[model samples]
Target: MSFRSEPFLWIHLAGLAVLPLFLELTWLGLAIAESLVPVWLELILLAIVGIVPIAWMQWQKPFDIFSLLFVALQPQQLTSQQRQILRLFKTRKHRVLTLFAVLAMGWALWKLAVFAPLAAPAAARLTQSRGLGLGLAIVGFLGSNLFLQVPISVLGVLLTSNGQFEVTEPLTPEEVSQSVTVLGFRVGNILPTVASNNL
Candidate 1:
């Protein structure tokens, strides 16, 4: 079901939206708090944000967001040259995922630096804030979004275009499905759980 189609999905999304807001409020409180607060508490809150969504996906695999993202990918039409490009990317998925993982770790470091002050407060929460244990949170945001679209879009482009080369051929539905299936592997290699069926 679409996010707007059903009340439950909407309700679930709306409810989940509050979580980040709560996290933001806590960060704000940390930034402005006068006394040293428990660092573990901040860690736990970040953990909850990461766990809840994945848990939701685990608990409701078919209806989760990944399924929604790939729903329209089945009619994946591609030219013969485009298919060649797809094969090229598929051949080196390990390298691609490695790159993504490295970038993700770099992002984690960025978050730590950004939240450092809150991790160890020196003044009031409003005046000072930071985090010592925010790695999982960095994983949740970047890993999820990065895998969700950036990689998919890259593959999608190759699927629909001949790159600098141009093509002129009438496409068939079966050919399209085959090309889309190839793309599933492209993204699947990066994240098996997210692209399991596509693989």
Candidate 2:
């Protein structure tokens, strides 16, 4: 089956990847509001923590990342071999492990971002203003999901396919032929009837 046909699976995987990030950001924002941290330092640290890994991944596997985005927009028709590779992800064990991996990675990153020497002060400041803290959390959550997590997940799927699928041209609908009905009615058969000169 094509990846597009499995909406539930994609949704599940996305939730697995982003929910932890949302919670982590919310907590970080709350913490930040409570501390006297340098906003510039916090922004710089966040940029380094988030962008560096993604940049490295993009550099290492440019094709995989591009293919992921392409496939996401126009899902490729899978070959039997490609389907076999995808089936592994559908298994209970793999599904559970994937969820765990995403969660573990998020947890590790959150700890790194919040507890690291320079970041610790910034994260501590999140709790000082509840409204601002939550606002930052919401914006961060949406931005990260849209720009970071989703692309990473797509890249993972493309890598799993192992370049087995081909990008086919888009399918177009064929023209329908006119036919006669059982009752002798001309269905979809348009014709001009000539009138007799005498009539």
Please report, in order, the local distance difference test score of every candidate based on alpha carbons: 0.36, 0.39
Model 2 over residues 1-199: C-alpha lDDT tens digits?
A: 3544333234434544665565466446635444356644554444455444443333322212112222321113222332343333333443343344445445544664465444447666444574576466545644453344434444355454434334322222110011100112222211112111111
What tens digits encode model 1's per-residue C-alpha lDDT throughout 1-199?
Answer: 1112322223223343444443443334343433345655654454455434433332222121222333332234332433333333322442353345445534543454357566445324233323422433435443343333233334333344343224334335464444333212212222344334322
TM-score, every prediction: 0.31, 0.32
lDDT of residue 28 for candidate 1? 41
**What stretches of model 2 exceed 4 Å from their correct place?**
1-31, 35-76, 102-128, 138-199
Q: Please identify model 1 stretches exceeding 4 Å from their true place.
A: 1-70, 93-97, 103-107, 110-114, 118-199
